[model samples]
Target: MKINLRKSLICINQQKLIAIFLVFMFLGFTLAKPEFASSYSINNILCTMALYGIASLGMTLVILTGGTDLSAGSVMALSGVIGAGLLGKAFSAANPVSLPFAATVLIALIFSGLIGYLNGIVITKLKIAPFVATLAMMSIARGLVYVVADSVVQGVSGSPITFMNDGYSLLGQGKIGAVPVQFIVYVILFLIVFVFLKYTRTGRSIYTVGGNIDTAKLAGIKTNKIIVLTYTVSSILVGISGLILVGRLSSASTVAAKGYELDFITAVALGGTSVAGGRGSVIGTLLGTAFLAVLNNGLDIVNVKSFYQYLIKGLILVFAVCADLFMNKRVKKS
Candidate 1:
């Protein structure tokens, strides 16, 4: 009981510190660029957070199990392309074909889930390291994007597929009074995941597996299934993000969401989630997502060069990983 209490306190303290830092960062940005304080800029920041938060939530789950999915970015692109194709935007102008929004989403989820399942099988059955397995999947998915694009587009094998339905696009761009639809989707996903992780048996199993797979198996937890489920779930979330992204951009391309896996890792780690696994929260991930979004928006407002922004973000990621490792070591000692 005492140990659990101590851990809880530590978690709260870390979250508080992150919150304080976020407030200070926001204020500094607003002061530096007064325009940033405007409602428009604030909305944009929230939108950015939502875009990244959706994927990071899934990443938090996979990472919690001591596994990582480097193919999330590629999966996002693949799902987007497939979803666009199913939406019938790629059909002939004279013979336009379109499916319901629900169908499009379902198709994308299933396709993405299949890819995620493949990642799981490779890791579990073949005994491949998570990093190497996911890296291979990343390449496979990226390469397949051209094949999907070719089937959708007539001339170019890698051309972008445009989504023409305004209603479909509304999922990404619509606002309910003042709240953006995309952010609403993020909040909904966050709440569902938060409850799942905090209040469900399977969620506990995920933590158990990440903390120690052998121990989990000894306890009859079916660790393999848990791992596969986590990867599949992560991919489904990525697929959802892909749809939202396509709606937002009104187009899907093979290059969409390129290099986002690194950003997802950075967000999960920044949220105080140990890279070694077994400790983290949905709320913390959300805060971390906001931090990254705000930092990028603020940097842009301050006219920071793109190259400098990349350097700063990369340094921040390194610091986050180091911090997580240090914290994990301390917890073990305690």
Candidate 2:
């Protein structure tokens, strides 16, 4: 009875452990730099959290299915360039296309979803590993960024597409009272995903697919469809993030969101999600993203060099993966 109780306690306390660590880290940062607690800095952290957190949520979904998306950053860039290029503005002098904001956003999301669908089809139909398949898509999407930029902006093949649109900008920069609109959107998305994963039939099937593909298949679940659906949803969320980024910057560069995939994966891993799949939560991911946002902002506040920041984040990722492996072993033993 004691051992059984201990096992249940372990399961319950994992998320709390992360939350406690986050609080301690926040306190430590505040002590090291007094200004770290300032409202401006806090708001900055929340904004960063929202920007990356939205994509990380999608990443959480992908990882939960024992898959990874190397193309997310590229997809984000693609979406941004595509959306910005299509806007009815004089941003890109070479591009003659102009569309309403809603149309532009819809078109961008559709393309993103298509890319994700192809990824899933390749993984399922071609029997390619997710890593290899997504790696290929990453290259393809990035190359398309350059291609799209060249086609739209003509002579300035690689230049950023700068635009001025107040309505679009509001998505990233507007605030409701003291809170940012983007952050609010992030929260809404988080709650929606949480409810979906916890309450929906398809959501539960994702877990079963990730936990044991063969068993899921035997249980009469269409594993392929579930995988495809998760990937599609992941890309669409990433597309939304891309649009928000463009709004915030008022520009979309060919290199926008470059290498951001690492940050998303790191956030999901640090949040206690299993790389092996089948055990994790969006709540854990939210906490993990908060921890990362604080760490980055705090590091900048203390004037830490970018190189060292990279090293520190890399170490944390390694540690998180190791810890996850250890926990999985313990759970199996119990």
Candidate 3:
């Protein structure tokens, strides 16, 4: 009875500790800068988080299945530019065609999903390690962005430049009452992914495949399908992120959102998700994102230089992975 009571106490304490950490972060920032907690600031950071969070959702899926995607940032740029092109005539300062906004969004999402599908084909059919495959895809994607842009498409308002700023701005910036649209989109996305992972057989198979593909196959799981799906999902989410990024910047640059794959992976790993796969959570990813958002927003509020942000961001990723590995070992021992 004493042993049982002690174990229960330990578990409860652990839960409380995690909760406290999250609360501290929110409150810490709120106190540090009162404006930090304001609706506008909160919404702005959340809006950005939601976009990256979408990409991270796909990345989290891929990582859980024990794979990596280095091309995500590049894919985002490629697909974002495509979405911009689709809105070619929207940039006119004089007048613009509204062209059903929903249609524009759907088109961008499908373009992103299609890119993911191609990634799936390469990894599953070519039998290449995800790292190598995604790396090659990254280069190819980046090159495509340049080729497509050709130094600038010049279509939106006579230049394919201001698509996000002028065209589908609603997706990222438009507000529903007091709340930004991104918050609603992210909440819906989060619920869907959380339910899928918790309740679906195929979702369970992702863990199995990642944990041990050979064993998963012996147990009748289609490992290749799972792997393909993983990359495809990552592609689609990253694509969504690209669209948001383009919107936020109000323009798609071949240089837009370059080098963000590491940021997504870091956010996942920091959320206490495993770098090795077969283990992770949506909650964890969300927490990781919040942490990053707070850090970035805080730094900006305090007037930190953008260059410092780059360095600090890298350190944070490294530390998060280290923390994950350390925590995993502790859990195993317990």
TM-score for each candidate, following the candidate numbering: 0.91, 0.93, 0.86
- What candidate 3 gets wrong by more than 4 Å, as runs, is 1-19, 90-103, 151-160, 164-167, 307-311, 318-334
Order of quality (TM-score): 2, 1, 3
lDDT of 2 by residue, 11-73 (tens): 634466567767887898899998999999999999999999999999999999999999999
**What total of clashing residue pairs does each candidate reach?**
0, 0, 6
Query: Residue 280's C-alpha lDDT in candidate 2?
Result: 87
Which candidate would rank higher by TM-score, 1 or 3? 1
**How far is 9's C-alpha from truth in model 1 (Å)?**
6.9
Q: Give the Å error, residue 55, model 1.
A: 0.7
| Whole-model lDDT values for every prediction | 0.85, 0.87, 0.75
lDDT of 1 by residue, 1-334 (tens): 9978878776534455567778998899888999988889888887888888999999999999998999999999998888887778654422155677788789888999999999998999999999999999999999988887777777756778875877557877888888899999899999999999989999989999999899999999988899899999999998888888888887888899999999898888788787788888878899889989989999999899999998988886676556556765776687
The TM-score, computed over Cα atoms with residue i paired to residue i, of candidate 1 is 0.91
RMSD of 3: 3.8
> Residue 206 of model 1: what lDDT?
92
Worst 10 residues of 3 by lDDT: 90-99
Q: 221-281, model 3: which lDDT tens digit per residue?
A: 9888888877777787788788777777777777777789988987787787777888878
- After superposing candidate 2, which stretches have Cα over 4 Å from the reference? 1-14, 90-92, 321-334
Q: Single out the weakest 10-residue window by summed lDDT for candidate 1.
A: 89-98
